[model samples]
Target: MSAPVCTIDATGIHVPSYDDVLAYFQTEFRGIYGSDVYLGNDSQDGQWVAILALAHYDSCTMAAAVYNSYSPTTGQGAGLSSNVKINGIARAIPTHSTVDLTIIGQAGTVISTGIATDGTHRWFLPSTVTIPPGGEIIVTASAEDAGAVEADPGTITTIGTPTRGWQTVTNVLAATAGAPVESDADLRRRQKVSTALPSLTVLEGIAGAVATIEGVTRYAPYENDTNVTDGDGVPPHSIAMVVEGGDAQAIAVAIASKKTPGAYTYGTTAEVVTDRYGLDHTIRFFRPTAKRVKVEISLTALTGYTSGIGTEIQTAVAQWLSELAIGEDVRYFRIAVPANLDNGADSKTYTLTDMQIAFNGDPLGYVDLTIAFNEAAFADPADITLVVT
Candidate 1:
């Protein structure tokens, strides 16, 4: 097979042309047989030999295509199927968990409930749970919200209500924790380290097991043998995890499944779980607290800037902030990253003259503009007041 062509614009790709393959055969034949005679189309023997070479070339091309699929760096590895294969092989598949909500309503009112429908997106109800009159029952989302509905508390409007007599319906607690489907890069990184060691007793093994549980976004496991005097039930030689997102019950079960026998487990968050063997275990882990950073930007529009630009800036900033992982800092200057905002479009000309930040309704002064943290940071576009001059 011919080698891949290199170009400045295109990444190297293996696509052997029929002419190239035919030329290779011709060169080989002349060099070996010591003859200038060219293979003719009319000759049956020559035609058969050419066909055989073509078949071999085709096989090489197919092999290259297959090899590329296995690599995460290649385009073929971007598909969900490829991601599943990589995760399944590595045993690091991220589990997605349902987002639970406590539906509240008036006493003695029966509300017909289903998934929360918001325009094109539908948040499914995993199971049917009834809300007692004047009380609340927990219902879970069919899939993870990934901090979308949680950032904007009341965005989930269409609660499956067959009739309107339910009076008032709202979730008492915010749906802040749900694990999203792991991205391709994350899956690839996990696969690389998963095979490096056995997951029976080490920290990697424990982390791998917990990661496979639905709704677990991030986790850090620590073995503290020196802090025997410490409270919170952390014993000598005990293992504890600082985890972000995922259901408490599922995380506990995952910890129980992978942890060494008789090893004491401790965390900031605790849950009782029965493993597949019907063995009950109490698991403790830390859940990262979310700090909502309200951003207000005052922009002075250039000549071409339009009214729509304000809304676009708000969306861009919100999405940028939402993508941050646990333990990541929210940098003040990075919030003004111009790439997403300065799109070369007509309405892209705007100067961010002033910016203000608030934590829990208290405006932060210039000295405290940067909210540095190790926990999750949430921001909503609606909460971001963008004023264009």
Candidate 2:
């Protein structure tokens, strides 16, 4: 049977519905063969066959349309970049010189390598590192065999020159985790949310523009119209933004691109932003100062609690806290959320009798922790000290 015509959704993208395709086949079969096509019943072999074929065709058409809806110019399309972390030691090299490192994957495979300066010590892999689901690969590093005369992994191979402060480097951290190619569903959702702004001169427009910047995961923009003068950076007609994770310079440029000409900016970092018109504008934007929170929890593990339960609980709490938006408070009761520790077989429940939030090793003596407008809360698995008694 011929495929049904594609229809456009409210987002102006063409999509085909399963029901529409099924109905079209039913009608076409009845008209051509002059016999009833019973689509609703399972016993009709001919009708079922036609329905399956039409459904596949409709799905392919919808997928193609969704793929074509986004591009780099639209600000909603996903661009190329992946996050990776590289860790190793600089051995016997001069204090201020640069060193080259190679990343080796499983079975002595050379995955990728990059150069790094001495001080920062850590480098992110330039290429995307894909670790299979539920599996991890052993990654090691070796000093660049050539280039940069003084830098070498040393003769011992395993044991480097300890006298010159050279140690074996073997750890990798994903600086910014690389995203896979955007799926169709994810692209469609982004398109729907990226509605045309009224004007690229308003507060929302400024925020929308900033959101499009790569590496920016979360951001919030606020305007202060109050007459009172406080140190909070929000003055009348001034815009203050709290942004998390991105190229700071790109964010500054985006702010300059969208904000009203006369509007004032208030925040920590200020940079000269050059717009597309070749004019330079100085813009100040706030990067969220991460305030580390220490979570102390007392839990009585039930049936699902295994020896590794403590690690699991710590991971769960850290993941939940990381997902919180900037300026959002950390609720005390969320610590008790059920954690699935037993794979998928059993649901684990715990009783959190006592929980505390500590800052700088001092307990806040409260359940809810409020973060400042300019700050974001960060919690790491190491910071979560879990005691199960």
Best by lDDT: 1
Model 2 C-alpha RMSD to native:
13.9
The CA-based lDDT of model 1 is what?
0.59
Candidate 1 lDDT tens digits, 1-389: 34433222245456667677777777677677667665788877479759977886777777666656655555234443454454554323344333444456554445443666444445655344444554554444543333334423455566654544443334323455443355666666555544533545567787776666555555566676674745434568888776665665677776776777777886545566776778767777665556677788887878877767777777778767766766567777777773237554743587778887666577654434332223566667786787668
lDDT of 2 by residue, 225-342 (tens): 6776455657777898877645556778778877787888987656567767888787887766556778887778677666576777788877677657788887876655623333
What candidate 2 gets wrong by more than 4 Å, as runs, is 1-193, 196-201, 275-279, 338-346, 364-366
TM-score for all models, in order of appearance: 0.58, 0.54
What value does the lDDT take at residue 336 in candidate 2?
57
The global C-alpha lDDT for each of the candidates, from Candidate 1 onward, is 0.59, 0.54
